[model samples]
Target: MPPSSAQARADTADELVTALDSLESLTSTDPERALASATEVEHRANLIGREDLTMRAQLVRGYALDRLGEVSSGGRIAHEVNRWATEHGHQALLARSHLQLSWFFNMIGDTPAQLEHALRGLECLDEHAPARIRADHLQTLAGALITNGSHEEARTRFQMAEDLAMQGGDVHLQIKVLNNRAFGEYVAGNAQAAMDTADRMLALAATHDFPLEITALDTVASAQMALGRHAEAERTLLSAAERSVGSRGANGEPEAQILLTLAETQRLLGATDRARTTLVRCMDACEEGGLAGVRVGALREQAELLAMEGNYRDAYELHKVFHAESEALVSAERDARARTLQAVFETDEARRESLRFREMSMRDPLTGLYNRRFVDERLDAMLGEWTASGSPFSIALVDLDHFKQVNDAFSHAMGDEVLKKVAEILTSAVTEPAFAARLGGEEFLLVMPDTSRQEAVFCCEAVGLLLRSHDWSTLIGEISITASFGVTSATASRGSRSALLAEADRNLYAAKRAGRDRAISDPTSER
Candidate 1:
């Protein structure tokens, strides 16, 4: 006999709630998947007229969205959810909702808002809130305190979180708090304490497949580097990078940092060729992972390498590019922080100014495509979402075929016109949910979220055909422009965003090697 409708609905609601609670485990590791699951819960809960579950799902969705770089979108949803949770007297939901808002504010660099929401979350915590929720709230409060320059209070909060984790026997949470403690110690210039804490974190992380393992290794490597133990630092970072190979990597930061530091160690050892190789690898990973700031580090390393090789002109050029890009990035971050304030104050003037500054900050100044900074942030967000939810995303690295010859044959001014036309064609190929960016010089990267490898390959082929058919002679008589394309896609078992990108870069290189005016995609790696 089938169950009654009431029984079925009750069972379904319980199942969703269980799933919703489990989402916390994946929140830091795979926000995309969490968001997808939360959205599913919201839809099903709404279908059953379960407002409580729907609100709960919405709160989780907001948190996931905030982590995945949709901070503004998450902020709005969290605000609504918080109000609903408060009015309904749902203490647990209210605590979690405040936690979500805190995360959103933290992402946008609004330290005050982060602290406010974190305190609010603590205020709402009661017996109704789970132990894990309380632990998370304490961790957020600690971080907020640190941002507020209250180190002693932050240390106390960390201790409280550690106590809670210990009481709950949550190895994962314990490792997380330990890693934070190590980082805090390092930042406070207590290298020895940081090393000891990192060792403890590593021991705990090794006993389980916790997400903090790579970060613990990084902490150890950082302490070693500070102590001038170059060989030790190099070995530790190598281990960290190896572990990071198949992971999402410490909220999207550890892998690149590990490799960058490893390269620095090699450079210090006077291993010029080895250091150069590592820097190249670092640059590729940085580009693929959309780690623009880390890419700047890679660029600086490369510039240093060139200077050591006595190639002063190229070295100087790279340094100049690095400085300009770094300043632009700082300006962009400041504008983002301002926008967060604007949202809070409900000021139209601040909003308008922020919009203008953002546009200026993201545009390439040439070709009008998004710049490297925008692409990096978007890629980081998309990767977090894709990794979490198992959604598909494709990336294409496009290189203009014979671009140098174009510059040599025609004047640089004429070559500029050709690039502009190519940019126009590339921009036309991307629609909503698809974006293209100039990664400086003659290369561009196109990203399509919710697109599979096959779909992306088809799009790349179409772009190729369009360029081949374009009337380039109209701009420069008898001269034609074409691009080499390489494509890769995300999958459930994908190693890292950098690996996905490196695969695409390899394929793009293959496209160029195969004859120049064609598109080639990594065939074996698709899901």
Candidate 2:
């Protein structure tokens, strides 16, 4: 006998609710059961031609598939849902579908697709949704933009999302948006700003009772680690990890991000064994949850830890996989950048050619001196070489005394000539094969490849005297300039690049303190 219409409608609604409840439960603790429930719902919904029910069922199924590491298949389903929602004028559903699809693409390292979906979701929300949906969409879009290397724009979007969320009284969304903005700031080399933002988010998270609180604390810890606040990072991460253990069975992205933060903080604190163990645990959690992207991130962190511990063979094998992932992400970013530049330049070939020239122009035009970009690249290479060769090098930081006074007394053009002359004089003073770079303004760096403390000191002193002795022909009269030099030699046992720079800067300050035209060398300090 056929079922009555009222009974059929009731049955369908009851079944959908049951499936959704089961799926939500499994999303945190048992994905297999959730997947089974989702599959049944999907079948029933399709038979009944209920679009909303079908979409919800598909969403749950896609999420389960993603957890099971079937990312491509899951992403296809998400895309289909997104397209269907758009075609049917389901604005809210369409926005959510695009947001989920963006995350799906991000899992596979398809940054362009991620950004496209995020932007589309944002557009949908702006055009037809409420403030809450708009804020959520903006947060997702900001995260995608940050991942794709659009730091400045991502920051603005994140801020706007946070403000909107706060105005709408959505503390959860505000915390999430703040965390997203902090990550962008960290990557953009603004560690202090990142730390500040993370602290604010953590405080806000604490006032709210939500799962996102744990995630926000983890972000705070990561920011603290980046800013060299290791003790604070350890404390924050420990608290987050402890809270997260209760929810570890969940297959949520936040859990993975928190675990990765804990592992990274451990690694930064030189607890290599602990870090490796934590990373392995994170990988296990990711696999269990069927979170493929998180698993990939855990793998990359494990590889880095192995590399740090001198397990190069194992690290290299892991890095091979990491390289493949990185290349995919980089290719997407390059394509996006290319498109953006093409819009600016009009011609594709011209844009490509201009990018090539811009890369080469990273070096200083005057004095044939390496610029800041070259210095950063060379420092990385130098560290690698030193690790292999066990050779010592010395770095001398030179600053001209009262440089602004020279420009004020003479014409600005003449000041440029004086700087050029000073560069030439310094270059001529160093007899050994060394690297000289202009570090912006009147600051310069000279790196002696294989020099001892005494030799480096002598070379720096000679350069200081050369600058003091050079006479500049100005319209008013001939003038002489003096420079202060600080010399710090690199040792095989030095901590890091930043440490070396700090030591050299300290000695340079000492030189200036002693006198305006003197050289200071500190060979006893091993900083």
Candidate 3:
């Protein structure tokens, strides 16, 4: 007798989930295959009506598309998933979506947007989150932080990510994190640190019986050269090539990188003929690996070789080709960033999920800023600290300036757009130790822990200026918008939550009465 229908359906569900896992596994090593598998898994999940699985499948598909050079479509998919995940309270999907968006931003060289998304992704991971997923997002955030010039923070994030990866026994993730950390250190001029990190990556791969990480080797060679170890660098490259077992690398491009680095090492070591020969091999590896970026480097290397050989004419010609390729690569990615988001998905599940998510939200649904409930909870603890230890802190009550004329003239939707923009400015202004929250409507509060009254006042003023000078027409057609702030610092008597806010509120009212678009901090006049 055939299997029962119920059993068959259960098996099918499990199979689809398993397929999704396989697709995700192939994402980095073989994106083309991952894309195909993702499509198939998506169909299977949809057929079975597993909304979560479908969302996961779509996210993986977007990642594969991005790796395969379809940035616009992938970004659209990612954004749609993000919106849906946010509505559903699906933290896993939300985290992945932000990670994908960060990737899109990084590809286009939008460091600020990349950093923003990376931070959001890291925020979404909780204790129950899978270790591998947590490590992936954390590692990505570390890279973004480093690129944004926060090396110390980046190092801490990297260490955390690597520790997580090691705990999970994910050898590949460990290698990847170590390699990236090393390269980031090298770029930041920490040569010894880079070498140590690269060495650790190699050690991890060797102990795990995994293929040699060509990228780590390349990083090691670069760090060696940076430390003036010319001969050592050459030896490292040779060992990497031999371990790689020909031109093909763990990934195609890394071998080309190794070859180019070797050629550069030779050139620096005064071996002109050897460098020229190595350059030819580099060009061959580049073509084989479809490494256009590395090919450009090879061309520049060839040009330098010719220049060294007293052939300035040929050298200059090759340099022109290299320059053109370089310019085109940069221009192409920026142009791709201009492709607007064009994805939409609507279902009763999504609609219902939004209402559910909103009910549980600690953050405002519209601006994604923390809501009053979250602020109240945090302030309760903060007040206890202030009452116990007299720990200094400050709060700024912010209110947007308007007479409801703009809302009536331009419609409430446009007014909402203006609010969101203000929220963005406020959100960006707050650093790690400080936070901004939406109390309700156009009212917000900035809480600064361990900050002086003067510092809080300065912060509010800067935010006010940003809002005042912002060209609102870009968001709403030709309009001026500003904000007023009331700042107050924490003290023993003011530790009472109501009293603290009332102080800020009085100052806020004073600012509104005097003139909008200004910050008021009355450290002198107090109860």
Candidate 4:
């Protein structure tokens, strides 16, 4: 007798569960294959119409996408899973989802959101949670806490994570924790502690012969650099760069970061020409790999190199430019308070929670600004609004030039502070009818309702001035900020959201190419 349809469906579910496990396992080492597998699994799960299978598949798929460097899309899917799991009482998935969101925020340099999600992830875990998951959660939470400047709590969490990893015999996880812990100690300005941790991690890696990547080496090099052991750091970084290139290929962020450190060491060693050449190569790698964080360092190194050559005039000008670029990292604490006020001002429990969730879903948790999802959905509606009222609607895509360096040179805490400050500036810049949103990364959006194209351009110009003139020194010493604006209007292209954004993006890049810290509007438009 043939198996019943119910039996077949049950068997398929069992098979999908197995597939999900395998898919998750392979994601880091084989993201492309994992992504392909995830796509198939998602399709099959959807066809089955089983929430259990569908959610699990999407979680793995999101993880795969994150591993593959599709952070934004991966985060969106993970966020969906988070919402679903929260509403459906799927505790485990909810925790994992939070972890995914934390990682996503980390990638985008959204430290506040990363910390928030990391905390939430840990809170969601229960006694029954798997040892590996618990260990990872602890490690993530510790890293977030360290980034946020909570050293005592971070140390406790780190110890717990370390113990869990050791007890579980997870050599790799233990190494990851050590790498992060060492970096965190360095960021905390504890060179000795960082060096000690790095040594322990190296010793462990050597004993096990784990194919650990160069993050630990980079931390050790950084510690050596901090201690003024330039020659030692140079040698270490050179070895790391060579090994990383051989194992992970050239032109990746890790390798680029290592090259950046190498260049800095070379500069310190008085190899000005070699430093310049390495800086050039590092900049190229950064550009190719979109390593904005490392690119900041490369730019600053340019200023240093110019100074080394006794080109004071060019060096001073370049230093000014470098600091201007660094201004993008500013005050996240204020963003949090604003979000809290928003939540508190909402009506009754149910309505308040609903509004909170709605806002959270639409807003980028890091900046407390409307996210891309909100932009995508709201732009069409705003287009309709302008179409109906016969008024004007304008938007400008603002990108922070050399913003990633804030996180790279200084600690992420400083970077978080900088990002928040920028959001605050943008918030203050916009009026009631005009609001700002963070589109992702270091990009922001300004939407002006009932405003003409000319008006929007003028507003953007003022914002540029505000950003440039603002006292960024209070946040990151001797730094200033500037952004490139690509402004567009409904009158120009009301057909679709993508069309409007594409034009603005084009003009934005034009401004970037033309020289940054300026706003540009479409000159061809019939105003």
Candidate 5:
């Protein structure tokens, strides 16, 4: 070839490499940048009549679109790239395109498409691709397999990725592999193992100053929460949230997740108001980020709060909305799975169905508020989800004043009537989307998912007034009931869910000490 021709070819090749690097960088952090770079490369390749460069550009653009949440457009671009690459015998580019397609399917939660593309990518690699790229491809495959509930296969793939990453001396790839392995461990209920892996990854990422270290911190928090180490979990989550908040755009999701966790811890501590405030922040962040999954979670927490506040009708409505959104996401995945299997069953579908059944069982027979078991289970789940999402929610421990005196003054039948009437009055008075459950013996627990401290106090006061005013008919004459409420909210100072609960319970006793019909709010002491 002439010198001029050779220089032109070299320039074209350099442009193609630059486009690929830019696209890869954008894949993790900025989809818009990736799309712009890929488009520029595509234009240049077309001008130069370089078919291979054009194919690569098309694949990069498709991957960018997929990350931007434009599934259909990205899929079409991937199809075009596949066609061109196959026609041009560019097997490496074709393999990468397939890998991108697999990731797209995974993002949309489409099991069948994810498996198909992943398998195709593996076949094309055929033991010849660079170790780092092959390891990445395997990691993706492991994630897809894990999501589809193939735990054993996922583990093997993750292990293979780890081995390859270590062999290639790729710290970033190794971190990713460890993170995925931790997820697999979590799904398999090996909480301790998961935590260990997450801790290692977080340490590595932090030491290396990895930009994506937040992900490892998030995983560690999740594992800690699952293990019931609420204090450690909250601390980890808050640190992650702080890091996320300090970062650029769309960083609020991690903060929201952490706030949700703090809320749950507060709720467990009996700081109903504090939990509510945390949840409100979490919902707001999710809304700002346009994170549909997080939004659904926030709504579900809101419904739980409403239920705790005795607004069963509204709670039921909100629950329906939450269930619908969750089902829609699952249905989309199911449709994609159905395309390849005779039948595809999701573990979550069965688990959620069972949960609904259990929820019904936990409802009080007469009052419809949650029973003690329900209260415990709901609190646990709320705390776990909040920790993962980093949002705040709160709880209140309430008790009817002088209940024994009322029962003694009237016949047992009349006492039963009194309890029923009191429950009804409470149900009607505090009708926010927060949750309320009867804890037996005139004690009640209320959960405020997304309410602030002020709002929670207002709610408690409202409930108190309604109870004091409710007319109770007895053989002696008409009477009234009174209740004392203790409220607390989530805070960095509170060590764990139990400590938060203890603090709130102490405050509740303080209210009782001051008088039977008052409310008290306080944060956990500095012990």
Candidate 6:
């Protein structure tokens, strides 16, 4: 006999496994080539009808897409693959799929989805899952946690990842985890600790790993910036950005972030013209590379610089554009979360877990309002409904006036009380088809569906007046609690959710400029 069919199938599977192994080496080195190779593997696996091979190929392909700045596309692929793996009852595939999805969201600045998906992946990992996969999941989850302001838990996760990576003898995984740990330290405001960690990491990666070294340098620059060493930060960031030149995903992403920081440092050093040039360069790079997060940063920096240059009108318009882009980024992340949820909610166990996770993730832990993630998703959905049904909707961006003074006079604890009190007011005020959410510190997004701009303004004015008149002395020792509101309605002029939110943000900025403790719906209206 020439060959048995079973033997031939076994040989083919071996070849595919080897191919997958080889392709992974190209991920940091040559992501474009890795993407092409992954496509080939997927094609062959589909023709062979090998579910295992298909899942493996898809995992790598999704990773490559994310690396190439196609995060949304990669997330969709990961979601579909996860659904297939679940249907096939392949536990290892399921874990890998979740891991890939987690990476996609992480790349796009979606920390909540990153943490949730990473946890799901870790939960699915069994003995059959690779040690490397387990380590990666732990590292990513730790990073997401750190970004979400969970320092202690993130440190614990980072330690676990470090231990796992050490046990597996994977230098790459160890270096990646170390970089994240350094960044975590920086985020915790420990500039000295972060610098020390990054220095050690730089030494470790100096000889063998260009990508890791670049990341370490970025960390060092961040710590320097935190420590108020603008000149040192600028020099370090310039070096990192220069070295990042040929490393598409590995270095390109950091280069963008580094450039933005470099520009900020330049601005702080009073090199206004130079800062503008650097920001322009950053914007161009981000646009060409499709780095949405980086682009938003560039826009914000440029707008700030414009304002500093006494170009108030241009700065305001630029800030409006920045707000629009930022909203789009948030919307993209929400869509990614929706895809992950769709893949997960296929079984009773998964459905229950998802419900619990959403309850935790969607609400701001401090204020009990819907978080920015929820706000973005809801805004996008409402915009779509408004477009389709000719229904009216409006948004108000509410920001507390002189709130920092209260925090300084009392404490953040008292400040938290104030926020909670405001949250309570907004929650109580909102009725059916209307909701409120905390956008971030000292800011809230109030949305009203099926309501005109005029009606929305009325509600916002009432809230603003209520806040101005609220008896905050009982909680924070006689501090005034006033808020400024910006109101905008869905209109043909605002084509997208981002545009609509941007309009509201512009109006809000106008309200603050005129005077605090007021609501402004019309941009042209005199104060």
* Candidate 4 global lDDT: 0.80
lDDT of each: 0.80, 0.73, 0.81, 0.80, 0.73, 0.80
Name the best candidate (by lDDT). Answer: 3
**Candidate 5 global CA lDDT score:** 0.73
lDDT comparing candidate 3 with the true structure: 0.81
Cα RMSD (angstroms) for every candidate in the order listed = 24.3, 15.9, 16.1, 17.7, 24.2, 13.4
Cα error, candidate 4, residue 517 (Å): 56
RMSD in Å for model 5:
24.2
Task: Count the clashes in each prediction.
Answer: 3, 1, 0, 9, 45, 0
For residues 290-381, what per-residue lDDT tens digits would candidate 1 score against the true structure?
Answer: 88779888888888888888899999999999999889888978887776656643577557644664664566544678877787677878
TM per model? 0.60, 0.49, 0.61, 0.59, 0.57, 0.59
lDDT tens readout by residue for model 2, 26-71 = 6434566778888888888877778787887887787777666566
Residue 407 C-alpha lDDT in model 6: 69
Poorest lDDT segment (10 consecutive residues) of candidate 1: 246-255
lDDT of 4 by residue, 1-527 (tens): 99998998889988888898777767766777888898898888888788867887888888887776666568778877988998999988888899988887676555666777897898899978767779889888888767655565576678788888899897877888888888888888889888888889989999999866677788889988988989999988988888876444323888888888898899889999889888887888888886666777788888888898899899899888777666642234345434433332333543664465556667765577887888999888888777778877788999988887775677565766777788998999888867899876688999888887888889989988888888988778876788999988876444468888888899899889999988888785455
lDDT of 1: 0.80
